[model samples]
Target: MVKCRALKRLKDAPPSTPSKKQAILQHYMCVSPTAKQSLKRQSPSLSEKVLENMKGFIHETKQKRNSDARNAMHVISASVSGEKISKGEKSKAARKLGLQPRRLSGGQRIRTSVLRSEKSCYEFTKRKTRSDITSDETKKQAYDFWISPTVSHTSSNKTDVKRSRIGPNEYVSHQIHLLEKTQTEVFLDFKAKYPDFKISQRLFESYKPFFVMPVKQKHRNTCCCRQHIEVRILFKKCMEFRKNLHASNLDLTQENLPVFEHLNDICAETVCDKTALHAQCLNRSCKECGVEKLSFNDNELDTSRNARDIKWDKFEYTEINVKGRKTRTKLMLVSKKTKPGEMFNHFKSLLETFPAHQNRANWQSEQY
Candidate 1:
């Protein structure tokens, strides 16, 4: 009725000169909202029903916005969370809250199956489930990024087998520097990506899974081990075994311990790998297995616990003769979760918003 009355007033305007009347019509066309959009005013009851529907639509929109606001959460298994939540309890809670689209995605959805054998490395080659990654260009780029063809080398040809396995001293020092650069770059990128960090006495609360692959001393380096133990045992006599081991990262002075001749005879290759010795990484690519053992000990090198442990590098497994029953296992430890840095998640939401091919394709790329 208000719109009708307003329209009537405009239509029933007083007479005016021809030019003035023409100006008034033009101004009214520019200003009158009803003139531009026809309004077939509804009956009162029908209008009430329409208003009720609009209220429902607005309520639904508000609810969806509230639900979406909590897209990411600090969640874990009940056991890990220290809460006894059964499947039923979770389902009941979900129902009570009217939660929609309650499904896990990305690496979190990866099944918790152990990769325990060398042959199992093939399983990790590509995480794509179906024919989503058909674009040859995309495939080529991903392959190149993951498996770059680069060969590591040493400048001097020290023909001695023992010294060859243990790199030259100059090279080791250079390697330590390289390690520093790699670790700093990667972690800085990680920190930038995940700005939300909470620190406590015993734990680091992060949105992404964080692991510091410990700097391992070569259990096999008799030269390193002998000199290290002598200097540590002599200087840090009060320190515990692990503390002495950890302290080796700081102590660089080569003590004038007796030049134990035939050190090779003492530190034989066989004795280098004692199962109890926390020297070498189980992963074969570990520079410890090579001469670059000191590099990983400090947070300087590319010390990603997951990077060294990637399944692709010369995958090997121990043939554990467990009770005379042979069990072959391939093992790989990877980041359990990943948080994209800053603006990346804005792009991430473009995929997560829909349940279509583009969304799934984006999911695969981000997860990779």
Candidate 2:
């Protein structure tokens, strides 16, 4: 009877003020469903407890994926042995249990490409067994195996080094030099063209040690003859082991110009050459009047003489002695310099025109 009377009095209140009943009940049972009426209206269905839990799970999953990617990245540094696939086992297991699989999309393809490139880099190296041979004597014995007269290729693929003296006809090459540049453009292009070889430039200035001629065959047990020397070079050519090119433009006098021959001043010297790669891009076939071609001939060298591949970037010159009597030899890159790296800019006012090197009269005269 008392509960029925209380419900009747609560229900008998104005229809608009149902909140009063909620306030009364909130004073008792703190977990009353109506206690969250305002919160429920603002955020329907998903309760605060469920939303907090979901947020924590998402944060944890993200951290785990980052950890996985970091660990996978390590595999790229070491030699691939096909053994790393098992490391993904845990990932496979977790994915099977309804956990969202970590999908890399476009990023994964990039990582895969990097791995393929690293593996293809060692295709040219000749693989050898550790127990096969030893020192200089054994090395010569091994050479005889291929140079043996009976071998069909002995007439073609013969190579003669220092060990043999009178086996056949052999010539000697000497002197070697190294030149390098600081510009990244030439190096970058060369690297892109030949990624497998060592990215090094060895500029040979003097009589460089290119190769030797072959003499005798293995059956004779002595070095090959001069007739065989030509054979050795042919073999080297076919193998493409030589560093330089067989034919390249050679113009060495373009650096130091003839400025009033008696003045002993080299204002400038220009070099010209014909090359397709350096031609203008207006039309791939159009080679004439191409600004793309360098003003100097730094590239396309003679492979027969063994000169390091040249792609001169900039032609450097600095007044060496006092009175600026002579200019010094400088380096150049295949590409031009940056604005900050340029030699000079006249339109922006002379860099040293502020009453420094040039007197007021000279500076004014030049300005006018």
Candidate 3:
């Protein structure tokens, strides 16, 4: 296995950060002379492993200390209202709070609301899930917007106008046009010139035509907008295909993706029933009594601890022919939890199970 590079401790960390070996050597001074001699006496090569482990432990300790200091400083600063917070202090506080001081939105560094407590942040995030984009009616509107070749100003029907408080204005039209032609920075610059256009990001989603695909860093922001729309439509079709397949009780032998077989199956002792309502129960409902709880399952416990080790770059995608005159669809590659590093060709024989043209035809038939 490839080893991870050692993290530098804050004390030894410099403007020009020292290498792993240099950092380890610098930290060796903290070890008592007797302890160092004992490590050398155990085995000449053993000291290297001991030093490596020590380096990791020291780095973690430094990080914890820094975090504690930040939290204490924040609580003190927030409670003392008279103390003037400078730009530098404000930026530091924002970093500590896991917030952006100014986010680039609609072409400006607009200040976002700061939440004082974790409970407030959680509540704010929970409210965002109720966005109109997730509503079935809004999804139908989005589908209509997707099918239209050009964004015209003719969508003034009651359904379209009633969805958003601020209906389609000239500024919104201009913003959508900018999204089609330029990057986010250019769109923001355009909005800056028009002070009256005070549209929020949420408002943009309400007007279906104003939907802009985010430029992802994975593609270095060079993702083809046309292809992005095609893939998105394909994903929607895949969801429909999966639902129909499951409803029909059809076996998924050909389309089966790699998964943790053990994790998918419930433990024999775990079974929730009417009895669970009044008693300490098994079958996963009661964490204290459930047989399948992480405390009782060692494998699951270990997997949960190491799950975050999966790297973002390891994520893979492929195109497979799924329907209609060799029309292809994108599939995200997921690793089996049991054997995370094991590679297998699972999609080589999967067939086109859904009629793609049927959905496309339905969209085309709609009058916008």
TM-score of each candidate? 0.16, 0.14, 0.16
TM-score: model 1 vs. ground truth = 0.16
Instruction: Give lDDT tens digits, candidate 3, residues 154-271.
Output: 3212222211112232111111211222333433543464445454444434433332333222212222333333433333433343354455555543234112222112222233
lDDT of 2 by residue, 17-38 (tens): 6687678666645666665665
lDDT against the true structure, per candidate, is 0.30, 0.31, 0.34
Distance from true location, Cα of 337 in model 2, Å: 63
Ranking by TM-score: 3, 1, 2
Give the per-residue lDDT of model 1 (tens digit) for 82-141. 124344465553333333224322112221121222122223323333333334343333
Candidate 3 ranges with C-alpha deviation above 4 Å: 1-25, 28-366
Off by over 4 Å in 2: 1-69, 73-111, 123-368
With candidate 3 superimposed using the best TM-score fit, by how many Å does residue 135's alpha carbon deviate from the native? Answer: 42
| Ranking of all predicted structures according to lDDT, beginning with the best and ending with the worst | 3, 2, 1
The TM-score of candidate 2 is: 0.14
